[model samples]
Target: MGLKSFLSRPLAAYTVRQYQQWTRQPELAQQRILQTLVRQGRATAFGRDHGLGGVRNAQEFQQRVPVRDYEGLSPYFDRVKQGESSVLWPGQPLYLAKTSGTTSGTKYIPITKDSIGNHINGAKDALLHYVHASGKPQFLDGKLMFLSGSPELEEVGGIKTGRLSGISNHHVPAYLRRNQLPSYPTNIIEDWEQKLDRVVDETLDQPMTLISGIPPWVQMYFDRITQRTGRPVGEVFPAFQLFVYGGVNFEPYRRKLLESIGRTVDTVELFPASEGFFAFQDEPHNPGMLLLADAGIYYEFIPAEQFYEPNPPRLTLAEVELDRNYALVVSSNAGLWGYSVGDTVRFVSLRPHRVVVTGRIKHFLSAFGEHVIGEEVEQTLREALQQFPEAEVVEFTVAPRVSEAETEPSRHEWLVEFARPPQDLAAFAAALDAGLRRRNVYYDDLLAGNILAPLLLTPLPAGAFQRYMRSQGKLGGQNKVPRLSNDRALAGGLLSVG
Candidate 1:
């Protein structure tokens, strides 16, 4: 073993043990976190305005501070933007993580000194866990690459501001930073297409032991390399053994990614975001990510089915049950109080509090009362792929196309871009319909009653979705096409481009 791996093993073992100890008492740890947050919040301007002076527990906190998204809390954020101290947190924030989403146009999330460790250490601990479990830590020896946002940050109110990935770029540990790839100049290129070409040029022949990014962008990089060299990524870089991915589920892009690799490589899943790092896959076989209970963030859950209800029951970790979908709400040291992160998660294991990202709170197909979420669609597609091994999807989205006639019912429209189109399109569509019926009862019911016809599958030409994103100026590592939407806007957009 090299000095790095040799030293990492013992440290990994100790860290994992310590983490396991706290995970065993999740509620206790969370309660302690709540107390700290409440104590510190009393000193903030927003907290004082929200009647947080007497808040002692969850109920009181909830009553004093209602759940708010970016728009609802923009008043306080505006103050922070103008360099106001003690607006949200005690002092001025260390950085502002600027992110753009489909719903919230642009949001500047604060990341303070108290919360920065969660962002950095969460990633480090995940890799260390892999080092301990896999027992093959040579990934540290070669060039470790994180295809992320630019390290070039602009100043906002005397605070560094940029994408969360970019903010993370500035804080990579020195040991790994020495081995990071694509050079600083290549990463700062604003145009994704140009940056990707430069990335291909710089790392085509390097010893890439690990490649980390959102899945779609990583697939794009692999495509570029294979197109140039006529060799699979595995052959191109024999040392590449680990792929770390976040921001989206990996299953939709998994088959194509593995085919490009031409071999199996271990993967690690993370649940990091600009708000805070929430979870990471702790065990090799466990599909669910272990929730970071002791981190600077305090987590709450609202049942997903009732998310739109006026007063939904908010539950703590101890009150949560298994296999139920819930919207994630969090209070953190970053000055976000009762903040809705807009993510839906399902708990698969309560003992260690492991969760799977079900979907986005707003990104669903509920137009016809058949609320089909992200995880369901992704899983259904995975099943459908089994029947047609020749077909590999590049990207896809679903939206309901309502009928103009009163008697004629609408159908779900599926716009799929394939890396390799299936030979029999009708057969592929039937397979998808069958799989979705097995997973979602409401969608199945609609078909049974003739309220909805079989989903229409439009095999889009390759690069169609990428073109749409480019047109919107959102083609990059940080942006992705929504898996499914409720309205015809995205569907119309995709069809218009094709």
Candidate 2:
């Protein structure tokens, strides 16, 4: 079945166009989607009781149903966990993808047939864009490798526990199954001891062309493969052309990968999640432009200034402006309505409606980029960390400092809280300086002079993040430590470095 899906390019392209047409009609799409959500709510007994039955338009629906976070849907998620699809969908859900959020034990994201199609379409769109740009219909003609956690689907003991990647593998279409390199069969969750080794063994001699996954996992794969084969990665996998990565910033990790491969490989960024696939780099040459999958989502944008507004303008895809940064608010067929995924993005061009993901509003830092967010920093930080893993940061924060005197330079001050205490502070700082150079050329040149000082590493007192979370009445559950710092007082109170 998987092999059939892999080989049926014409059928795949037909399905892709069907998905794209949904987004092309901005006005009609909104009307149809609004009606569907209301109908779904009525069918599920939510609309009549709440008197939300008459939500005739998107605007009216938004007004009637206040925006809700995952915390607000705990009761609904719990019902799905008990194998009841009452609040999530109409029938028995196919599976639940486990996720950790700021205020829960674990979020059982219901993966229904409708939701699964959304994910598949999103992934297919990424591939379609690549094929269109490269003019390579047989892009997946060779071994296409994905370094996911594991392929285990159903779990016993009434618990759905595993990485999101593991759960997704079960729903892969039958036709595209052959494209997966069958090197490893062990469940990563069950066989944590040998997972990495198995991965190395599987791809050692394979002619892998397209590689995709998190930077850490991919980088680790390179290290293991190089050590096992006694050859550079380029020699081991000569067919590799496109490298797709996401989940964290690539800036910090890029230099190490380039050095290891000894050449620049084509790279693309994928903006996706277990809940849904949001966007992807549309053009190889232009990393900034991410074309929205209009068909799968009813798009909305909350301008950065109005992000916290009670009723921000939830612009349709047609209403979106070019070059303006806004947080994404989307309503999808997969049971998410008026939901903000917390990602911030800007339009590069709007004629084709392409966007550039700027940052996560929740993870913004006040620094060189006023709106500096996780994706940007992650890109640079990953490149840096690959070179100096010893400089692993347990926590970090950055703040803007005013030049007290004319002689002082205007710059952003970073207070890095490292995991391991370094014996030589200067050496630790210089290592970071070198790592940044490799990740971003501009940063490297800035550090060469006094423009940006070598980073200041402050070994934090162990358990600071845990202690801070406890103080906030947020302990003993999933929590996100602050990734970016603009609030000086909050940063100082929460963090202390030796």
C-alpha lDDT of residue 463 in model 2:
59
Give lDDT per model, in order: 0.91, 0.62
Candidate 1 global CA lDDT score = 0.91
Tell me each candidate's TM-score: 0.98, 0.73
Which stretches of candidate 2 lie above 4 Å from their native place? 1-24, 49-52, 137-139, 154-162, 182-184, 187-193, 288-293, 366-372, 375-482, 485-498
lDDT per residue as tens, model 2, 1-498: 233335546655665576567546545665676677577765553455444577777667777665566676566666656655445456655666666664466666666666677666666667766666665545466677776766565552254545567666665555556666544364343443266677666767777777777774576577677788787787788877778887655554565565566566788787776667777776777756455544456667888757877767777676788767788876665665566777788888664566766667776654553455555455555555655555555445555554568776645455655555456666655665465456456555655666655555445575565466556544321133445666565457566323
In the range 423-458, model 1's lDDT, one tens digit per residue, is 899999999999999999999999999989999998
